[model samples]
Target: MATMPSSEACSMALAMAAVEKGTGDDRGMETLQYSGWRCHRKIHARRPAGGMMPAVRRVPAHGSWQRTRGVMVASQFITQLAFTLGLPFLPLYLQQLGVHDPQRAALWAGASATFSGLAMALMAPIWGRLADRVGRKAMVLRATFAGVLVVGGMALVQGPVALLALRLLQGLLTGTVSASNTLVADSVPKNKLGSSMALMQTAVFAGAAGGPLIGGVIADRFGYRWPFGATAALLLLSGLLVLLGSREEFKPQARTQPSRSERRARTRQIWLLLGPIIVVNFLDQLAGSVVGPVLPLVIAHLAGGQQSGVATLTGTILGSVAVSASIGALIAGRLTGRWPPPQVVAACAGGAAVFALLQGLASSVLLLGVFRVIMGLFIGGTLPAANVLLGNLVPPQDRGVAFGLTASATSLGFAAGPLLGALLVHVGLRAPFLLTSGLLALECLWMVWSSRRLNSASG
Candidate 1:
């Protein structure tokens, strides 16, 4: 734990010595208590009339909070792994659903991803607002259970159109990752928020890494549809784990009626604080999703082998990217305290832009895999950095809607990426990567400009 600042320490020492001197200066002590609390809500520096450090009383609660954090992280890992299992094979699934032409497959892949994203984008804020009123845990349960239904329904669809519709519904109902993140944000101490968010992000990357490798093997052995069923089972298991292992004490905000001027001012303040962060979040995901729709086909073309062999090779590439992302998340979690998140985000964006451009130029699968892994390392930091910044910028009571808005931005970016991919893939497989790189580069410049503007305004 960090010690109090020098001024706070001095006030605390004087307050204690005064009490010890048997002065019984009630008004002075009360004033000190109020001042201490005002200076920092996390540190309860003042003591009772005969007292010791009141902050010490909060240690046991902190320990419990740590335990809760552990449970949520584990749950997040399981849920993410389950959720992402089908993603690597989405284009393959489209192939099985009656699309035969590669160009059309790419377009459909992008369209399906965009459809899901649009649905999720529409629903995220509603779920987020509901989470604040109900409980985050409830939202997690709702998402996982909905995943069981929506993903499982994918198994029953007969064509690409039906599959896309189910996926759209899936987005409407499922947001387990977001729900788990909200839970983590609510549970951790204020000072440890970034670390906790980073740790959760690592779990996300781990699951993303593991799921593709496992799902690829499963899809190869049992066919594309089995993975959906398997994903449903995993979602069911995750829901059970959350129910049995985690606890949340939720208190709904009191309803208040505000004047139009006050509401307008609040809305303007929110826009000023969150607008840039949301755009950055969206554009980052958009850059990454450019590869999602056509990666398997690219691997298949490079490997020049049976479908089964291609599936395995594609999994290897996907897993490598995810594993690199996990490593990046670990590094990002450590660096949040040392560097400002916007600076980190800008650096990561620039790095991703460079690596993505390199990926576009690669001629072989091996070279492409290497570039993607490097790109993943940079791409991984973006979300956690944005989340940490959002957490700090918004009050706890409003964070659900704030994160929801970010989620919407992310979905919008994700929706756009594949569409861009579909359109560019006709030019060549390399086009999407180059295009994404250009978008990311543009984003980096914008973020740097925004950060400088904000800094100058503050100064």
Candidate 2:
């Protein structure tokens, strides 16, 4: 038996003893006495006044997370699809709008893209911090609905400047992906995080792949404006889905401020994990976008300068690569569920680098397409693995900030890639591809070395 205390402890313990012995009719009375004794014990122990204990809050499990994921995925799919669908034809639209100079057209298009990315990069972290305070689902819903309005309004813009301004606004408002990632980190069990993140990556890539094909067809048949109109409608519908289908359940943390040392430790941890992710983002975007803005021109040149047919062929190449990538993402997701994320990421990076290098070596259009398809497969798996690795590294409370930082890194890489590709085109058409491939190879080495270090530390 446990030892009982003397007179003071007995008085402190009497109420609890009475409650233990009390019947249903006497339970309330004994509970009240127990509260009084608890207060007394607190005073004796020199604890905070009132002796009130904070309630243990239970976080929502699979069901809530899954529902939020579904809504978020739907919203992302539609908005991203709409945005990507119009991207391939934006320069063409600019040219048609009286900016016939190729240099000017390219400059304007690049500026619009840069502005959009800058807006997103600047706003993502702010929105993320807000989500942590208010509620993630609410922020997601707001972003989705705001995207609907901004993108839909983009259809009515009369000039390139107006379009660029709207695009910037759209980026500032739409942060659904970042919020969704944070929600998943909070709601999903640790064991299933890799698979869930993989599924998210698949959705993003699949949307990206399908959008261009559909947009190209629409642009070829209907008009440039028609594609934007269609995209706007889709975004509106997606926003509705998010508003109707999603629910937010906020759980606030205990109110305790961190010390300077604790804050420094956390900051160090964040930078340590963030460094590799930033590198991965840069390399991934560099590899993907190095071939992007110029692929149509490449196809046109290959097809003996038939610019009219380039859109269709470019769409075909993009779609083919995306299909391969989707399959790779699914496979990687399953594999990573069983394997460590860093190992999977390193393998994917190495494979993508080899295929990207082969892209620069292709002597025929058929061979280039084949290499691109292979590259897509490997590249498709990289983002999912990176996200899963991040999910594992960060704590739930800080996940929103971590995801926002990642979004910023990705946006920066994306913003820079097209410009780099354009600049390299001055040297040679294949220079960008070769350079990106080399960078990717370096990234692969980094991943391998980092994974080894992580393993050694863990062991």
Candidate 3:
């Protein structure tokens, strides 16, 4: 956690950290007692009495948090795998519904994804806020079980229009990633957060990397709708895993009644501090998703008349990109160590932009796959650099709100990108690819400008 730079940030930190890491264990409950809480200079550094990191007295909550981490990571993998199992085939599935034309199918596919993204964007903050009040585990259950219904219903949809409704509902009701992350964060101490977070992310990549390929094979052999049923079952299993394996003794924060003026002032402060970082997140997610809906159309086009195996082929390409992206994320730390994060972000965005353009020009599936896989490497770098900026830029106490806004931005971006791309599909399949390149180029230019501004200010 970054140090609080101002008295306001320090105060906010104190308010937010009250019931930090109180959870249940195998033998019994481990309660947090803030009775002897003090900021000892010997233990850390001398800070003001109400500075960040107020020491707390607590019973070591056994190894339950550790176990919780394990269970949650597994749950994350299963949940993500379940989601990707059917989502990536939306365009192909649209053809099965009634839209046989590739261009029209791509449009509906993008619409489906956009509707879902819009719902998630609208509801994310609401659900995130409620997770504090109602409980994170409850939110996770809400998301998981909701998916069991929404995705399962997708299997029964007879038309493209009906599918779009379910997609939107899926977004409004499900946010397993955000809910699970919140639960894991609340369940563990701050120091171990990095490892816990990394593990969770690894699970996401692992599941995503395999899900498309596996789901594709299933679709080819059985049918498109079969994967949807499989996804629902997997989601059920994921919910059960988290429900039975993990425990949360959640303690909600004491309600604060800040004045209207005070709340407005705080909102301004957050915007000033986090506005650029939030934009970066939004654009990053936007760039990543813009090509997703139309990739199957491109693959089918390149494959000529062999529509029979397009599902499997599409899945392979998507799975490969996911794997490459994961590897890129893993190596980003080393790259950041050698240069400033802004510079790293700029470099990677530039690379991604170049590769995205190459992808648009590729004549064959193999060439397109190569270009996308390479683009994924650069795509992966952007997130880690943005995260570094967040750590450096946002104060510890203020990060919760910062991250919450970022999540909203991400959802909006995800919703916007595909819709924008789908609109571009009217021009040509390659138009979306060209658009992805343009977005990444803009992202690169922004980072470069930001890097120069930071360097000049420091100099």
Top model by lDDT, which number?
A: 1
Q: Tell me the tens digit of each residue's lDDT in model 2 across 10-125.
A: 45443332322223444333221121111222111221234534321234555887887677667667766776777776667777666775546655666676677778888888
Global CA lDDT computed for model 3: 0.75
lDDT string, candidate 1, 1-459, tens digits: 112236656456444422222444454332211112112233222345555532111122567678778888888888778777787788888888899787798888899889989998999999999988898889988988999998988877899989888878987888777788888787677678888888888888888888888888888888888878888898888889888887776666544577897678768767776788888978888988887887887777776634667767787788888888888887887777887777888888899999999988888889999999999999888788778877776655677788888888888888889988888877887888888899899878877877863332222
TM-score of each: 0.87, 0.84, 0.82
Pairs that collide in candidate 3 are none
User: Each model's C-alpha lDDT?
Assistant: 0.77, 0.70, 0.75
> What are the per-residue Cα lDDT tens digits for candidate 3 across 1-459?
222235455444444334423332222432332211121111212223554444333332759788888899899989988989888999888988999987788788888888898888888878877776677789889999999999999999999989999999998999887677667666665445444554665577678888999999999998899999999999999999989999877655444578997668766655654666677778888988888888787888888857878889888988888788767766664665556777877888899999999999999999999999899878876766665455445433233344556777888888998888888887888888888898889988887777754432212
User: What TM-score does model 1 achieve against the real structure?
Assistant: 0.87
Q: Which pairs clash in model 1?
A: none
The number of clashing residue pairs in each candidate reads 0, 0, 0
Which ranges of candidate 1 are over 4 A from the true structure? 1-40, 43-60, 305-308, 452-459
If the candidates were sorted by their TM-score against the true structure, best first, what order would they fall in? 1, 2, 3
For every candidate, C-alpha RMSD to the true structure in Å: 6.3, 8.9, 6.0
